[model samples]
Target: MQRITSFFRFCRGRAKLKRRAAAMGFMNHHHQTAISSGQEGIKTVGVDNHNLCDFSSNSDLCICIVTWNMNGKVSYEDLAELVGSSRKFDLLVVGLQEVPRDNILRLLQAALEETHIVLGKAIMQSLQLYVFGPKNSDLLVKVELQVDKHSVGGFGGLIRRKKGAVAIRINYKGFRMVFITCHLSAHASKVEERNCQCKHISHSLFSKNWNPYAKPAHITVWLGDLNYRIQGIDTHPARNLIQKDLHGTLTSNDQLLQEAERGHIFNGYCEGTLTFKPTYKYNVGSSKYDTSYKVRVPAWTDRILFKIEDAKKINATLRFYESMDDIYSSDHKPVKAHLCLKLNKLLSA
Candidate 1:
C-alpha cells in the first residue's frame, strides 16, 4: 500500500526538467516534459520531479509487477486500466515485449504521473523495463541507482534487439534489490533455446565486472514474456482445458516449471500459482485463442518470479496474481502480481 506525504508543492516550472524533456522527441512539443534528463543517478520522469513518499521506517513495502507482450500494438486509451487501480502500490515495475513504438513510454508516464515518479527505464529495441516509485518518497533517490541491459538472441547478432533483457538495480536504505525484465525466444519447440537465454541472462546481466563490490541482490524479481509453452498436450486438448477453466491441469506440463525444477533455468525462483488461463496466442481484440491456420497453442508466456537472499531476514508474501481480461488490444493478456515485503524496521531503515 502507498503512504501519503505532505512534501508536495506546485512550482511554476523547473528548467532542468524542461531541458530533459527535449530528449524524448517522440513526445509532441505541446506536451510537457515527461522523461528524465538522462544525466547522473536515478533520473526522475514525468511532471513531478518532487521527492517520493517517505519510506523512512521499517514498513511493509508493496510492489506491483506487470508483464505484457503487446504483439507490436499498443492501446493508448487502455493505458490507465492496464496499470490497474485496484490498490495503491509503493513501487510499480512493468515489463513489455514486442513493443512497437517508444512513444508508449511517454503515454504511460502521463498515466501514472499523479501517484508515481519514474525511477528510470531500460530499453532494448522492443523489450523494455519501466520502474516507478511512490511520489514524494526519497527512499529510492537517496542511494545510487544502476541500469544494465543485455540481448541474448539473433543469428550472429542480426536481430539481437528483438530478444533481450533490461534491468534496474537500487540499494534502497541498504536493502539491495534488482528488477529484471526480459523477452526470450518464442514457440513451443524452442524450450532449450529459452532455457539457454535465461541462463545467459542470469550470468551476463549485472555481471561482477560491472559492479565493483560484486554484491548479490538481496531481492531479485525476474519477469517478462518467457515464451515457454505447455508440453504433453496439443492445441485442441489445451483449448478444452482452458474452456473448462482447468488451468491447473495445463500448468502440470509447463516447460518453464519443468526446467526450473530440474535446475536448468531460473533455479530457486518462486512464482505465484497459475490460476488464470494462458495469456498468449489469442486472436487480437477477443477472448478466443489463435484462430489462424497455425492455431497457436495457448500458454502462460508472460510471468513474474522473485527470489530473496534470506527469508529469515526479510518476509515476502504474494498478495494477489491475476490477468486483465478487459484489455483486448494485444493478442496476449497482461498479467500482474502484488507482492508485500515485511522487514525488520532497522533493516529497512
Candidate 2:
C-alpha cells in the first residue's frame, strides 16, 4: 500500500514539474515577443523620421545609390536631372564600366552639386594612358584598386584578372561605406572565372584580413552591371546562347543569392522587382526596336546588393523607380533603393 502511495506521489510530482516548465516556457516566449515588439516599434519610428525628412540633423546617417555601366554616352545634363528627381538619396556611387575620361565625370560632379568619383582599375589605367597622359596623371593616382590587392580562388585553368571589379569608399555624416562596382567576364566559358570573382568579393568583405583602407566596421555594397542573371531559365537571345552548357553557374547573381540565403549577404530586388529595362537597341534608322521586346529580356544583369544587417533595417515597400521618361541616358536603366537609417537607435546604442 505504501509502495503504491509513493508511486502516486512521484507521478503527481512529475505532473507538477511539467506544468511549471510549460508555464515558464510560455512566460519566456511572452517576454521575448514583448521585447521584439518594442524594438520593432522603435525602429519603425526611426525609419518614419528618415523617410519623412532630410537626414541633415542626423549626420551619422548615410544614403548610397549606385548606377552601373553609365558609359560616357549618358550626358551630364540628363544624369543630373535624373539624380535631382530622386526623393531622399544623399550619396550616389556610380560604377561606370566604360567611362572614357575625367571630363564627363567632372561635369557630372559639378552638376550633381555634392558628388565624387572613384574610377575602376580598367578605367583608371585606360584613362591615365590615353586621356590624361603621363604629365597630368597625379589626380587619378589616388583612386585605390581592390582587384590588384586581392587574389581570387577557383578551379584549375580559370582566368583571374583584376579588370572586372572597382570600388569606392564614401565618407558621409561621420559614417563610412564601401561601394564595389563589378563587371564580370561575360563569356559562357568563364563560369569558373565568375565563381572565383564572387569568392574574392565574399572573402574581401567578410574575412579578417588586415588593411587600413578595407575595414569591417564600414558597410559594404557590391553593385554594378554583373552581366549574369539569377533566373532559373533563359529568355533573351544573348542569354540563351550563354546558357547552353554552363547551366547558370556562370552567373554572379546565382552565387550571391546562394551566399545571401546562408545569411552572408542580401539582395534588394529579390521581391519580384525589375532593376533594368532593355536600354540597348541597334539604331535601325526609321523606327526603334519595339520596346515591348524588352519584356522577353532574360536575367537582371544590373543589380544592387547590401550586407544582411543593412537589409534588416530596410522597410518592405522600398521604391525602385523604372518608368522615368529619360531614355537617352544609357543602355541600362538606373536602379535606386530608398534606405532609411535608424539614427536614434544607432546613436543611443
Candidate 3:
C-alpha cells in the first residue's frame, strides 16, 4: 500500500481501475522511469553458469518465475511476455495480489489454450498463484495448493488478505519444487511485521499437504511484493540517486536482504543480482518515479528469489533476470527471472 504521508496529496490522474480495485486497490499505478531489459533473443544453449551447470547440458526442464502485484489491473500483453506463446519455459510460476476473481485469468488461459499450455491457478483471498506449462510435457506428477490468512483486517474478517500467502508445491519427473507467493504487511516501518508473516509462511504453509515426504523442496521459489522500503536516508537524496542510476547503494539498507543475512527471514533463500531499478510506487503509463505527495522512496517491492539445497545435484542456474517496464498496469512494476533447474531424483529417495 502506498501510504502517502499526511503532508502529501493523492495522485491517480483520471484513470479508473478495473475489477478488484475498490478494496485491494490501495496502491495506484506509477508513471516513473522503469528499468527495462533487452528483449529475449535467440538464446543459445550453453553449459555455462548463465544457462545451467554441466548436468543440464540437455536442459531437461526450464522454469520461468514471475511476480506481480496487479493492483486490480490486467494486461494480456504482460501475460504473453511473461510465459511467451511459444512455450519457451517448461514451467511458468506466476504470483499476483489483489486479483478479486478469475474472470481475466480465464481469458488469459483461453488465449494460451490455443498454444496447448495447461493452466493451473489458486487464489487465497487477495493473493493468487498460477502455474502453466506445455500441455504434453507430462512432467507434472502432483500439484498441492495451500493458503493461509495470517493477518486479520477489515471489520469482522470481511477481507481476508490484509496479510497472507498462497503456495503450490509441484512434483515433476520425480523431482519436487515448492513455489510460494505472498503479500506481506506493507509500508516502510513494518519490517518486523513483514518478517513475522514470512516466518509463518516458511513454517506452517509448507505442511504435509505440500509434500508427502515432509522433505524440503529440491527447488524453492519465494517471491512477491515483500513491501521492504528504504531506511536511514532522505527521500529527495534517494530519488536523486535513483534518477542518476546509483540504485545499487540502496540494497545495503534493504530490510529483506539484511534480515536474510542475519537468519531472521528468508533464511535459506537467495535472490539474484538486482541489476534493474526498484519496481515500486510509479505513475501510470510513464517513466517517472512515485510522483505522489507521499513520495514513497523507491524500493524493490516486487521480487522473485529462490533457494536450491543441493545445487550440485539439482543445479539451479539463472539465465536472465529483469523487470518489465512497459507493462504499467499497476503502481508496481512486474519482476521476472528465467531459470534452468535440474530435478534431483535422490531428494525423494
Alpha carbon lDDT of each predicted model: 0.73, 0.42, 0.66
Alpha-carbon runs more than 4 Å astray in model 1: 1-59, 155-161, 212-214, 345-349
Per-residue CA lDDT of model 2 for 88-203, tens digit only, reads 44444555554544465556546554334434322342111001111233434543333222222111212122244545443344344456666654533343345445555555
Per-residue lDDT of candidate 3, residues 1-349 (tens digit): 2332211111122222411343574532321111122222112222234434332455667777888887766667766765555556677788887664446566567767755454466666677787776676544445443433333222113223445677776766555677888787678866656665676567666454545757666778887888888787877888888888898888786767765555556645667777788888888776678778888888888888777767667866677678888787678888887777655556444
lDDT of 1 at 88: 66
lDDT of 3: 0.66
TM-score of 1: 0.79
Cα miss at 129, model 3 (Å)? 0.2
Count steric clashes of candidate 2.
0
TM-score of 3: 0.76
> Which has the higher TM-score value, candidate number 1 or candidate number 2?
1
Best by TM-score: 1
TM-score of each: 0.79, 0.53, 0.76
Instruction: Report the lDDT tens digits of candidate 1 across residue range 50-95.
Output: 4332332333677889998887777676778878664367778898
